[model samples]
Target: MTPKIVIFDWDGTLIDSVDHIADSLHLAATELGFPALERDAYKDIIGLGIIEALQTLYPGLAMDEIQAIREGYGRYFFSKQTTPQNVFAGISELLAELAGANAQLAVATGKSRRGLARALESSGLGAHFAVTRCADETRSKPDPAMLMEIVEHFGIEPGEAVMIGDTIYDMDMAQRIGMPAIGVEWGVHPRARLEEFAPAAVASDMAALRQALYLA
Candidate 1:
């Protein structure tokens, strides 16, 4: 863990929220008269914000219609759903180990701040992250806003920080910002899809992830 500063993506990397996200998204899409997204569609459109994901799902939709869909989705996501979340297996142990090693941890996610905060508090993982960059706090992934903001917050060089996530968007963000990326196979995206982004390394699980970081 020589880098010390590690930023993680939340949804598929640390917590398993795919089923919930898919269900919610399906509901929203149906209400908007759009086709339901399959698992592969979900995997493809993830890492972007809800609006962006909806745009990807329905490319020909008008701006006003898209806004309406976004509003409907947000209402459903906040009021009717509980995020359908569960921490991944071995994540708690891994976080504990990272903390014990005196490494600096943070979160840079596309989730809204309130949503991310509630999820973290509910999962008992809030204390593990020193800083969190949410959708409201920065531009979305591929922009490097979250990564650069977190690096500045930690007073560390971007090269000394590692971005851990399951999507190519995370790898692209890290690369754009001059940080190494650790792609995880356990996430929503396929390993081959992630490799398309040319990540610094790929980890099959938390234990292997630790070893990769150790070598770095």
Candidate 2:
């Protein structure tokens, strides 16, 4: 059965911004004279909040260092053009179809509130979601705090909602709260990585994703 509430992850799942994000992180580290890891290493942290991602990538950072990297990353990321064109093909249609079906859509992302605001505006997808939860406003992914908040806001049971994302963190958070999860492949993490979390389904394309949501 289709869920009444559908929660989505932002960066990799809705938009094709993984390369842009990974590149910006590399640029930030290079600008700070910090050692750069493989591009995949940057991509691996896509679902995590900026501070948490930075801490995982470069451990033992002083508060000042974390702030500096955060600022630098923000500078690099915002410098690029973020437009509706970044949204994945078929996403707008999918959101429309879900909304038409009376599904309550929401975003549970690792993006800062400010960042998500800009993305929503640029992507022209903001009004499609009934609500949004940002990492800066609550505990980050894999903690279940943000997801729980969204579920609570909608006054729905965990089983009545479904999470669709591109990372293990998304699956882990939903699992912790007993919410069903669906993984998308064309994102930061591979199918194998998402499979380890035992998602309800792993979609390779938008059509498959729609089918997984019982829309097709």
Per-residue lDDT tens digits of candidate 2, residues 136-174? Answer: 999888889998898899887898899999999999999
Q: How many collisions per candidate?
A: 0, 0
| Candidate 2 Cα outliers beyond 4 Å, as residue runs | none
**By TM-score, how accurate is candidate 1?**
0.90
Which pairs of residues clash in candidate 2, taking residues 3 or more apart in a chain or in different chains?
A: none
Worst 10 residues of 1 by lDDT: 76-85
* Candidate 1 local lDDT, 143-185, one digit each (tens): 8998999999988899988999998889888988779899999
Q: What is each predicted model's overall lDDT from 0 to 1?
A: 0.80, 0.93
Give the best candidate by TM-score: 2
TM-score of each: 0.90, 0.98
Highest lDDT against the true fold, candidate = 2
Where model 1 places Cα greater than 4 Å from the true spot, the runs are 78-85
* TM-score of model 2 (CA atoms): 0.98
